[model samples]
Every structure is written in C-alpha cells, then in structure tokens.
Target: MRSPARRAPRDADSLWRWATLSPALLLMAALGLLPVLNLFVLGFFDVRWTDGGSSWSFVGTRHYAALPGDPLFRASILNTTLFALGAVAGQMLLGFALALLCHKATRGRVFWRAVFVLPVLIPGIVIGAMWKLLLNPEFGAIAQVFEMVELEPVDWLGEASTALLAVIMVDIWHWTPFCFLLFLAGLESLPRDVYEAARVDGARGWQELRYITLPLMWPTIVVTFVFRLVLAFKVFDEVYLLTGGGPGTATEVVAFTIYQRFFTEDRAGYGSAMAVAVIFLIFLMLAAAAAARRRVQS
Candidate 1:
C-alpha cells in the first residue's frame, strides 16, 4: 500500500531481521530438519546390513505399506495407547493430591518437597533397575509384603497379564513427583487475595476450591497432562529393563518395536517407516496441544 520510498525501509528491515535469524535457521535445518529429511528418504528404501556389508536400494513405500496389517505393530500401538492413558491419568491425579498436601503443610516443607522430588531426580534406567530389584519376587521387600497376605510371591514384571501394568505403575511412581512439583509451583504462585476475598464472603473449602483453585490451575493441569502423555507414549527404558517387551511382545511399546526393526531384525527401511509414523502421531498431538493452549490463553 505504500510508495517506493516508504516500502524500502520496511523491506530493508525485514531483510535485516532475516539476516539476523539466518544462523539459527541454518542450525535448525542442519540439526533438526536434515535428519527428518534423511529419515523420509530411508523409509522408501530396502536398507540392509548383513555379514558386515551395508546397502541401500530404492523400494518405494513398501515398509510403510505393510504397517497397517502388521499384527505386532498393531499390538504395540494398543499397548502404547493403554500405557499413555493409564500412566498419565495416574500421575496427574496422584501428583495433584501430593501437591495439594505439600501446599497445605506448614512444617518441614523442604523435607517433604525433597522426598517427593527425589525419584524424578534419579535417571530412568536407574529407577528401572531399582524397581526391578524391589519387585524381584523371591527376596524383594514388595514380594515379602505380598507374602504376608498369603499370596506366596507375585512375579510382577514376568507375567504377560501384569507386565504392562507393572511398567505403568513404575512410570506413575517415577513421574508423579514431576507433576507434584509443577502443581505445587502453580498453587503457590496463585494470588493470595483471591482466597482472602473468598473467605470474607463466607466461602468454605469445597466452594473455594471449585470456584477458585480448579479454574486457576486448569492451565497447569493441561500442560502437565500433555507433557506426561507425550513422555508416556515414548516409554522404553523401564519396560526394557523390567519386561523386555516379553512374555512375548506383551509390553512392546512403539519405541521398542522401532528398536527391534532397526537393530535386531535389521529392517532399516521398515524401522524408518515406523519411526516416521510415530513422529507423525507425535506431531499431531503437539499441534492439537498448541491449538488448545492458544485457545486457553485467548
């Protein structure tokens, strides 16, 4: 809409902005985008490594074409979904409860906070190993406790029926602390005047929480839910250490399936296809979350 003289400065400014951003743009292309592009190319090939020989031959969507009918992949999808649902819900509810309790405690605040957050500080593999020992059926304390109920011993991670549930429990135990920390932060950062006004108006516990606490904390709740859901979808280390996706692929998550295809089965193209599909699913979830977040903000 502007004349040449006016438009020149604006165009120059735009160019200068892009010039400043060029380094970051290039870095992202190199680090983030290039790998994805490579993955897409790999997904169309018959890639192989056998007898110390490696080769790549163009096959054109064969791997991806087979994904829908693959039973193991289908089972992995179901298991991953169930794990996400169970783990995220358990973590969010339990974490909110812990956070609320921590928020109300006036004494030993630091000690209680530290105690709850310690599990999150530990590495995933380490936590998996720790729980593995604790669930060791024969001599572990958990098994011993079950023995007191005359149940003999329960091989928590070894059974097909219980393997996924066991891993989900471990995930809930490890991640609930993270949710607690965030919820506690959100709770404390809330304005104090809201409560004072509510109290002055004769509002009691349930009413205050229903009108004030829940409404205010809804944003944090959404954020925690999305983050935990994403993490739970990618669960592998604990399942690997505890169940190895076994009693025959019972606890097989998408990530583990990708691993098997890539390494053990040496189906590089198929693995790449699987990875691409999983990445697409994650992309959709993140996009939805972003839209919801913008709506919440608006």
Candidate 2:
C-alpha cells in the first residue's frame, strides 16, 4: 500500500498543475461562455438605447414568438439552411476527392497540398470580394471569358436565382481545403497494415476504398461534416461582401439578418433572439448528426 506521505508530493504536484491551468480555464470561461450567457439572457429582453444609455425591459419570449411570423426571418432561415446544406455537401465531396487524389499521389503531394490550401489561407472577406469581382457580368474576368467563348456574361451575384448558389460555390472553394486537410490527415493516420492485407487479398482500388477506407474514415467524415455545417450555418462574410443580401433578400442568411437587426435596425433584443434560435437550431442539427452516426456504428 502507498503511504500517505508518498501521496502528499503527488497531490501537491496535481494541485500545482491545476493552479497553473486555472488562469487559462478562467480566461476560456470568460471569453467563450460569458458572451453566450449574456446573449441568451438578452434574447428575452426588449433593449432600447436611450440618450447615452441603454435600457432593458423584460419581454419574456416576445422576440421568439415573433420569429415564426416575421417574413424576413423566415426567408433568412430558408436561405441559411439552403446555403449550409449546399456549401457543406459541395465542400465534403470535393475535399474528399482531393484528399483521395493527394493521398494516392506518388510525387508533388506537397505542391498539390499547398495549392489546395491556398484558398483556405485567404481571408473569407477577401474570397468574397474576389468572387464578387470575378462574377461581375460587366468587365470582369468571367465576362471576358464568356466573351471569348461566345457566351453571354452572367451576373451571378445580381440575379436572385443565382446569388445564393454563387455564394455557396465561393464558400465551397474557400473551405474545401479545410476538409481536404482533415481527410488527408485522417487517411494518413489509418493503419497501413489493413491496406497491405486488403492488397494481398487482391482487393481492387474501388473495393478497398468502399470496404476499408470509408468504414475507417466514417468518424472523420462525420466530424468534418458537422464542423463545416456549423460554420456554413454561420456564414455572413460572403453574403455581406459579395451580394449584401441583395437581389431581394436572396442571400440573406441568419447571421447577416442578425447583424442587420443588431446594428442596422438597432433591434438588439430581437437580434439576440435570432442568434439564440440559430444556436439552438445548430444544436438540433448536431444532435441529429450524432444520432445518425450512432445508428451507423450500431
């Protein structure tokens, strides 16, 4: 049996470790949790800014009640859902394909990785601006390409039908590299012996990928999907920079709608409600994904 005296130094060391980590833990709680708690509380209030001061009146779910009846909010919710689904789907498919290609490459893997990751390093705002210019129907690179190809120049961001799709494409371009990096890392970390055994059994490329690779990589795929879905749901920069929710609220996502409510309309409480609703919706989506993963595993 270990003596109490011997355990004293270990306990002291454990306390010292916690003491060292306390500051960081407190900082994280303050930085991450405080704002969320504040937002949640603010969602139930009617905050009005007076002369040099702000006043809060308890509204008690009025903002949440209004959400279902607000036409703009409904539109924004639809647009946000569409954007998230489209962006996540495209990103996952393209990223996984790129990962597979890079993983199987015999040479130039570093170069390909750098090329793929370049878009991810660029700021989202920059990507929005760059795509805005490229998709311009008048005197843009895409316009020039259209002219050269004897095709009509399409105003992707100007048209209501194409605006959301354009932003989704831009988001896919920007974030696919993130998925690629994750999937590639997942692929590399997979046990090589499994592949060796599959090869010895004369498993073809498609068969190995179908039977061995996908099953092994399911968790990674789920994680990437959920992470990207959350990010996609929170998309604001592309709509803000590229379309500004123009062409009649075509690209008005939840985040941009919240931004407009808080800053433009000065409706802080209602905006907070929308923000809280979005968080709840994201939680539901994550829960659904988790349930799906559990079913698959079972």
Candidate 3:
C-alpha cells in the first residue's frame, strides 16, 4: 500500500536534481558572478596603492564624473566607435563579395576557400607585429612600394593621423577572413532549388543577388555584424602593440585606456569603473541587436 512510499516523495527527486547541478552553479557563482560583482563594487570605491602596497577608500562617483572631463577618454570613445563602424562595414562588403565569388566558382573552390580563411588562423599578436614591421617607414615593404610609385614614404605608426588607420587596416586584414567564412557557410547552406528557380525565371546575377541572396542571408549578416561590433569595440591588443595609444591617445581605444589606468597608473577602482561602463555599453548594443534579430525573425 501507500504506493511504494510514493516514490520517496517528489520533493526528494527535486532535491536530488538540485544537488546534482549544485557544483556547476557554484562554479559559475565563483568564477563569473563574483568577479562581475566585485568589479561593480570596486567601480564605486576609490582604491589606490600606497608606498607600502596597501590600498584605500570610497570616493563615490568621483571617477565616473571625471570620465566626462577626460579628453583622452573622449578621444578613445570616438576612436573605438569609428573602428567598429569601419571594420564592420568593410568586412561585411568584402566577405559578401568573396562568398558570392566562391559560390559561383567552378574550379579550385576548396583552394580558394582555404586561401580566404588563412588570415583567420594567424594569432592576433603576430598580425599586429607583422603589420607594425610592414608599415615601418624606413624599410618596410609597403614603404618600398610607395617609393617605387614615386610617392613620399608615409609614417604609418608615427603620426596620430595615420596610426589609427594603420591599426584599422591590420584588423581588417586579419578579421575579414572570419566574416568571409561565415558568409560562405551561409551561402552553401541555402536551398539550391531557389537559385535554380530564379535562373529559370531569367534573373540576372545582380538581380538574383539583390532579391534572393541578400534577403535570405540577413540572419547570417546580422550575426556577423553583431560579433564584429563586439570584437571591434573591445579592440586593444593591436592598438596597444602597434601604437601604444600614441602619438598621444589618438589610437587609444577604451580597452587600452582601461589597461593604462589599471596597470600603469595603478588606479584599480577607476579602471573598474571604466570597465563597467564598457560592459554596460556592450550590453546595450547586444540587446539592440537581439531586438532587431527578433523583429527580423518575426
């Protein structure tokens, strides 16, 4: 009777499931949640190292207030925005074109695909350093090419005007391959019959692309755009390596600004404030992208 102890009570089953998942939940709380919470707390507090290596107290929103008056911070925000926009636009156009070409190519498709993807496999640091050397005004191959064309050698990393552009070029060279691969995958996964039907309808290449290809590829394009936006917004390594945020904060993206505050100035609390601001901005962007995606899907 009693239905075999009623399966040891359904409450016990729920407890057992909770117990099984506790470790993972705890791990996430420890590694992910705690750090974010700590950063949030630190952002509001004033922490500075002493000669004896001890630290200090709460300055409330002092750092946040100071951000608006900081010229370098303003410049960094502008540079980051420009880099994200330029990189996303350039990569999307080039990637879409490469994807279409690959889709239509009848010979050596695999080889061409491999060639297109080669830049993605290179390490970011190596790409940065390579570009740094290659853009050197004195003996770089690029300088040599300019010389051949009877043009004056350009100081790619020397001046503020050219430094950011140099970083942007390096980023584009490395990341366009990623966008191209994503676009190629999207193109290949589309229904062939649709294209065949379009051909039967006497649609020209441009017409087919505009009407059929782009419409169907919007989701993939959106994904690539969001990813690139996030990455480009957080760009640090190449800018750090190539320009060191010089000539005088011209190429300093937000990440490098935070790094300089945290490591060089040892203002951990201020750095945390900047970092939290960055996180907030990125979250807002991602939320907007998600909303747009949902609208498109609907």
Q: Which candidate should be chosen as best, given lDDT against the real structure?
A: 2
Q: Tell me the TM-score of each prediction against the true structure.
A: 0.91, 0.93, 0.90
Off by over 4 Å in 1: 1-18, 50-53, 291-298
TM-score winner among the candidates? Answer: 2
Extract clashing residue pairs from model 2.
none
C-alpha lDDT (0 to 100) for residue 239 of candidate 1? 80
Query: Candidate 3 regions off by >4 Å?
Result: 1-22, 51-53
What lDDT would candidate 3 get against the real structure? 0.89
Per-residue accuracy of model 2 over 181-211 as CA lDDT, tens digit each: 9999999999999999999999989999999
| Model 1 C-alpha lDDT per residue in residues 113-136, reported as the tens digit of each score | 999999899997888789999989
Clashes of 1: 0
* Cα TM-score of candidate 1: 0.91
The TM-score of candidate 2 is: 0.93
Per-residue lDDT of candidate 3, residues 180-206 (tens digit) = 999999999999999899999899878
